[model samples]
Target chain A: MGVNTEPDVLPEARVIAVAGLGLIGGSLARRLAECGRRVIAWNHRPAPYEQARAAGIECVDDVTDLARAVPDVLVLCTPLKAMPDVLAKLAPVLDSRTVLTDVGSVKGQVRDEVKAAGLNDLYVGAHPMAGNEFSGYAASDPSLYDDALWAVTFDECTSYDRLLVVIDMICEGVGDRIIAIDDDTHDQAAALISHMPHVVSTALANELAETPSRNIAQALAAGCWRDMTRVALTDPDRTRAMVEEDAANVAQLLHHMSDRLESMATLLESGDDEALAQVRDFFAVARPYREYKARERGGAAHESVTVRIGGDEASWRDQLLASAKRGEHIMHMTDRTHAIAEIRTALV
Target chain B: MGVNTEPDVLPEARVIAVAGLGLIGGSLARRLAECGRRVIAWNHRPAPYEQARAAGIECVDDVTDLARAVPDVLVLCTPLKAMPDVLAKLAPVLDSRTVLTDVGSVKGQVRDEVKAAGLNDLYVGAHPMAGNEFSGYAASDPSLYDDALWAVTFDECTSYDRLLVVIDMICEGVGDRIIAIDDDTHDQAAALISHMPHVVSTALANELAETPSRNIAQALAAGCWRDMTRVALTDPDRTRAMVEEDAANVAQLLHHMSDRLESMATLLESGDDEALAQVRDFFAVARPYREYKARERGGAAHESVTVRIGGDEASWRDQLLASAKRGEHIMHMTDRTHAIAEIRTALV
Candidate 1:
């Protein structure tokens, strides 16, 4: 097999190594390779080895091979629970010149682990706010991070210029927009936006599980329940691990959500016209705020055309992207169900 | 100047009078007209009168005119709060031959009102499970009730044959499927399937309204939050009226939801691995059940193509339906946002 050497088209002379070839790592490696960089990938499992080799990416059989490659940048893409063990094992192999970053959802725990391993000076935290229902190396796509927001948390002791260079390199390689914030702030924001929503969704689904008329109700469920509970379809083990790690934050947010739900229940139960009016006013404020936020986020601006194609969505997305002109892109694609797939594309 | 008389093409020699020319009333009138039936509509408001008249449906100025024109059937399409008053007003004018029905979401209250108005023998409760985000006469379409589920509840004292004939006429006029249910069961099912979901959606939107990072979170919100909160964009007064009328059922459901949410919070807070695994198992059951229900509902079977056409969605939907082939239909059409309208059509 032909090994992927560093290409001349790359502006900087930097070797990149990606550990744990899951969706994120695999996608990163694919994007970096496409950007004319030498990318070496390592995975504990053997399933991704053939695919990585077939993609012309060098596969390291052992963690020591990662240090032997002498990569200037090392990206850890392991699951949250596996991170500490992986970090500890690889700490001996990492050199001072190797700048480390991760694509974990939570930043605080990773930051603590890096500090505990005496690698704070070489570590920066990153979370690409991009994912789909599917996971693993087989589902990896080069354009997964295109135009996605990447949250980066930097340590005070780390060299600012060196970290910035590495961030810029990754951003350029994957076409991701950077959002710099502190680790705590990142966790707080993520709890509200991501983890909290997941808990709400899962809990809602669980509620439905116990309802007597759930089957009938599900038959009649419109867009609301479908959207609200979409995240419940994710891998239970993976989600369980994430929620366990961020249990404190998730629990706090769930408590807040419970308070809000209780308030609504109390208002409805009050049987007072004024309380009903108050509830109405509450929704009146909510309606415009939600709409405004949706509009502000460019959710309402797309001129999209959705068509049903019965096959692999990624393949169809790739086919469309290849032939699409400037300003044309897939706005959204639904998970395949009943041998049918829906793809919404925004036409310029 | 013209009055709608009996049309010969209709199988039954019946005149259908529809009171309240809002979305449901106007659409019913229009569809009845299209089905070669004489439809006379009466609206308390002046705005819809001209529109109804323009659509070739005769408009009545008063309740007496509706009684005079409605020799066979009188359908009450007024709001929940106005229903008792309207029924009392029209009760003085109606004869025993007239079959009375309504398009109300809550059936128990309407049944009570019908009984109080001494029209129980002539009344049959009907609630069509079809609606759009928009309302009023201007948003009405002839195909609004086509292939939609129409829940019909009957009182024990009512004339079965007469009510069935009227129900058949209405079903034939609008091409709706009949779902026979008791009034109380109808209310309970509707609360779970429709009203409760609406409340959940509104509360979620209210949560977003109170969030400090709402704008940022909304920017990152994927299909989950968007779908879950879509109903929050509806008219607040109409929703408030419904919620108030069905406050008891809604409050009970909300209390149940709160309990479920609290249980989840307690589990997560407990930080017990077994508890977390139980929560995960909860989701495992929920996810498959939801998917199975969605699949059983034919949610995954649609072969729809959505195109962005910037204009009035109702007008576009009407035009498409008017020219569509025997099996084709408009599955859905989204409201115009940022000057872009999306219409999804199913090619049979």
Candidate 2:
């Protein structure tokens, strides 16, 4: 099926107001500024305001200043708990023509809050599935949106043309393969894929920390351990808000995950080789399913690589002399402790 | 408490046999060759032998050749299941003074197998906590061993001086972080840190596969999914071996992990804000543990960074030109995309 490609090419945006200056807000501001929109950024704290200014962004320190900007598009990039009041305060500044969207984790709660505030005509919910372990404006990559899934939640009230304009603008920024779903389903799925994993990883990390094995685990942990528990290092406040806001769905999925792990444990405990073999068989069935979904996100199976480094700095210089004298692989020599270089030969 | 510094340095190895030519064996061969040892490499297949030959390694196609070579040290680098027979066959070659070690996961089983085969004095179990997803001789780097842990297992019959010589050899190949642990404790710890996480990641990927919302999930799954499910994509045969060999310990750890996740689900289902808060608090306590470990891994993290690309190959060259003409921060390029040669600049 062909994707809809119609662009709502409005002549200009009057003003674009961003609700926060975390990673998303900062990126959106930069992108809007690139598109020649007069961007006004708002942050509650003095910290991000300075960061915004350093980036040559025009900053509004207060909500009233944001209201005065009279944005044609008001993007809420605040944490979930902070979204309701920000939406409420922006309602008076917003009109039917003004477009609003959020970069929040849970869409259903935010969508309900927007509708409850009686600004349904001016609002939609969106989640840009891109992030780094690091937060704040410094970590915001312009290409963070590229190849990510920007899930736009729509109901009957969402204007077709307005959605197109927002989609085009997002595509111009850090764009990815976009998926459309309604608020409820989008929220439930987000809980399953995103929020639930965070909760699981954090809980696992916590269990590791609480065990006597924690000390030994630290020594034994490799890249796999680091990768598996990475989300455990996320800002607790941000994840707490996400879990609390979408408690029911996260709870449901967590139950399902727990049950699956429990079954796996039982099979392992029984020491029945056939049962354990079945666990591997089950994963074989699951692998292709995951591969299919990952492809939709424009990702492929990651390219595995091997790297070889030769010589310490002192030995490197000696190697350079040895290679030059012996006419070997060493070229363009530089001296440093453990020089960053790649192997030209299959050293092993 | 000071570690023993005056441990015996091994006499130059007159002959050495490596039973596999994957990451560990390839690396061992290279180091042994560099250390002036006569190294004979054997692989289960001939392809790695070809690559080893190209790298100037002496390759022997048959395991019987190992008996005639009569290597002073036999470092078995095969999978766990293949260890016992490889050890038994190598027994004919082992002299009274011969020191032996095997680079395998789950040291306890291998330790027992070697003892059962009447080579207790000659055998030591070693696990090098370093690897990439890629395998085989071509992917092997001599430097892959640098600055990683070599967990060495010691038992009642192990000679002090012989242990030190093996430890010295491993330290030279890898790093000086040679942790000495009993076989049982090592197996239990491996269960916690390595095997348990594999089960968790595989089950998680499986869970995501079965979810009705996978279509939306595929788009939204980012680094978290990639990180959590990495072990899911690991070689199934290797995974099965690790799981079966240490079934009891892995089962115990899985029970603990399942219980933690269950409680998290319960809290979410009951909408216990306080309990949810506690879960977040638990993460707060756990995040530092991982952060501390990351700091310890140090330069190993840099090993994974892709090379940066810039200049004429940039896709955003036109955009950069336009932004530069418009007096933006397009001149302040920092990070560059390696593949696309795109210079990422913050637009001021």
Per-candidate Cα RMSD to the true structure, in Å, reads: 14.1, 19.8
Task: Please give each candidate's TM-score.
Answer: 0.76, 0.74
> Which residue ranges in model 2 land beyond 4 Å of their true spot?
A1-15, A37-72, A130-143, A146-148, A156-165, A168-177, A290-348, B1-15, B38-71, B91-93, B172-176, B294-348
Alpha-carbon deviation at A342 in model 1, angstroms: 32
> Which candidate leads the pack in DockQ?
2
TM-score for chain A, candidates 1 onward in order = 0.76, 0.71
lDDT of 1 at A202: 75
lDDT string, candidate 1, A306-332, tens digits: 433233433432232222311222232
lDDT of 1 by residue, B1-348 (tens): 111223222223257889898888888888888887788888988788777777788887886688776556788888787887898888888776677788888988999999999888777787776777678989999888877756666555555444444545555566664444457556765676667767777777777667654544454456666666767766667677777778788778778777777777788888677886777775676765555545546645544444332334334322322223112222222322111111112111
Docking class of 1: incorrect
- Local accuracy of candidate 2 as per-residue lDDT tens digits, B1-348: 001223232333356778899887888787667666677888888887766776667888777576566665668888777777887777666666667788888887888888877888777677877777787788888777666666667676665445544655654433334555667767887887778888888877777667655545644667777788877776756776778788888888888888887887787676656876766665576765656545545633221222222323333333322322221211111222221111121111
For model 2, residues A1-348, the per-residue Cα lDDT tens digits are 001222322322346778888888787777667656677888878676776666556887686577676566678888777767887777776656567778887877888889877888777677877776667877766566555556667676765445544554454333343444677777777787678888878877776677653555555667777788888776667777777788888888888888887887888877666886776675575666545444535644432222122333223323322221221221111221111222221110
Local error of candidate 2 at residue B296 (angstroms): 3.4
Question: What DockQ results do all the predictions give, each relative to the true complex?
Answer: 0.20, 0.22
